[model samples]
Target: MADAPQTMVIVGGGLAGAKAAETLRAEGFTGRVILLAEEREHPYERPPLSKGYLAGNSAREKVFVHDPTWYAANDVELHLGVTVDRIDRQAREVHLADDGVLGWSRLLLATGASPRTLDVPGAELGGIHYLRRLPDADRLRATLRTLGRENGTLLVVGAGWIGLEVAAAARAYGAEVTVVEPMATPLAVALGPELGRFFAQLHQDHGVRFHFGASVTSFEGQDGMVLAAHTDDGEEFPAHAVVVGIGAAPNTGLAAAAGLELATGPGEGGGVAVDGSLRTSDPLIHAAGDVASAEHPLFGRRFRVEHWANALNGGPAAARAMLGQEVVYDRVPYFFSDQYELGMEYSGYAAPGDYARVVLRGDAGRREFIAFWQADDGRVLAAMNVNIWDVTAPLQALIRSRRPVDPDRLADPGVPLTEL
Candidate 1:
């Protein structure tokens, strides 16, 4: 049995760590709670960094997870702008970059992910930005405005969620956007080529040019500023500014240095490995958010979801588990995105080969529809509602049921989703 919790320390100041701190106090744990944040800013959510905040639709203050005073008000020690150098797991202590030491009975590592950059030439040039933090968004937002005013082109690398969102935001600001992807369609890996083509069409309709089936060979720059991007096909796309949205890699350095067990499999998001309760190999240590690859009870496999919903929910779940409460973290993976006029909520997990086909319930041409990725036997693996609202619960329920449904009725607009 776990010892009575005493001092609890949480590393990483993102939404996961913040929510974990909140949940610890709400659970009536009287132990001292110390939250160590590497970033100088208070805990904040990152979705807006790519969407609203990037578009200037959401204020900077709106991204924070809690008010500045809330940490102190709840007796939770908040250490901002502090870096944890190493974890002395044997001593149950965390050593700070400043040489400070903090003893803890339980520890949580919510060290979120970092934006992955291109390895090609001129990748380090100025005017090339990657969006992952508040400051990144701040810089990109300013660059977009400048590009928009000058009628310049914003070159986007990769056709993933971040790239597409940035493309949409760039267009909204009246700047030209050109997306270069090695894949044939945007979001092909996540949404499949069919829906991926749909997204490609959406952006193409808005004047965003796409160079599909191409990869960036090098970035052309002058005097440390990027000028354009050269593709593998020898095509050159002029770029006043470039945004690299290849992907993000989980910040697992600290945990790995501590000798904690980590997931090594491909596509597992490469994070600290945890069980259903978010407990790592070491009983006294746990990890959540983008840093954790948790064994899900429902899916019967380890999954490290980097979406905002995972961080928002994983932190609290790990906290309850840390408190020795009966806990099972098996939330269906979820994420949302807003690009141009398209708003979408995706629930459940269905990779390319996992699902046999996609079933559509509404008109795809009109861009108001629900798409379901199902198994060969018609079991719902994942569902996405585009320009749809208030159906998350039912969609999640269908995924949880794990039972096959008639594809014909599933594709019928007359059939209620709850019936599935």
Candidate 2:
């Protein structure tokens, strides 16, 4: 008698989940590949939602990971608008919200994260927005266009990547923009104070107002529409529309309910704990993308990264591991941002306190520079190249090498990074 064919179940329809399914077929996995997505639309990438798509530079078709026909052609089962309510680990069954159940030989969780919302009053007002899904971006794009034509004000909360990116887009649309942040400078948590100030100045140069060291205490609205925002500093700014970009929390409710171990260490970002191979506590299950707190071999730390690059690579790694292939899943953390004419790419990881000081090469004033975040012992923890090209390989190599570099040589444009 022949054995029953193996079935692999994947939850979430974002980049990670979609790529995982594609990888299964690419690696010659003849078993069943079932992908369940809560969202009605096909799997799409998120970066364009905040960048080109929001700016109206890219069309809607460009966001999708694969064409609609690709899934069926590849013999992968694509179930849309279906939510996984519960994971019965003991029985290896997935309970759907619509009373459907699926038994899987292996499971992969790539549920991703959700945007954090404001607790202030009037947050639910009609003019407020959060950019996460395709629908959200479509609404935001229309709102920005309307505001621009009317010469209205756009109040953005938080100075993080999303907030700043939207501000840039709004400016391009010719809407007046104001950003309110609790931190001293924009991107302070990720890039430190000095570089944060540089970004602040960049936005300021483009006529975007900044209200730093302030928090929104309440929002004033009329007819169920947000009209203004009030800060704890006793100030109020007129807001025709508002966009909240406070950050995101991973979708770990399903995993936690199933008794899967979660990363609780400070700064692990509260994700499902996975080993270097992206395998979860139960060997039959694995986690990837934003919801995965993976133990990294290179950094010797377990961290969760919410970025397009991570999702693009993590899903394939998890799929290979699921096939019993050797996969370390130790790619350096990477992310990029585009605000106006400035474009930057950052590789490796380095929070504010993790690095001693920042070393710069090239001209920062001209916005063409490479900044290195080095530890006290001169080991490069991370590197960011602003408006620079063709240097990601050498920068990442320096990080993986774990070799202390001479600050003077690193700062010299005459010295090649590969030589250093």
Residue 375 alpha-carbon offset, candidate 2, angstroms: 0.6
Residue 188, model 2: lDDT of 92
> Candidate 1: where are CA atoms >4 Å away?
1-5
Residue ranges of candidate 2 with Cα displaced over 4 Å: none
* Candidate whose lDDT is highest: 2
Local accuracy of candidate 1 as per-residue lDDT tens digits, 18-133: 99999999999998999999999999999999899999898999999999999999999999999999999999999998999999999999999988879999889999998888
In candidate 1, what residue range of length 10 has the lowest lDDT sum?
A: 295-304
lDDT of 2 at 45: 98
Model 2 vs. true fold: TM: 0.99
Q: Could you tell me which residue pairs clash in candidate 1?
A: none
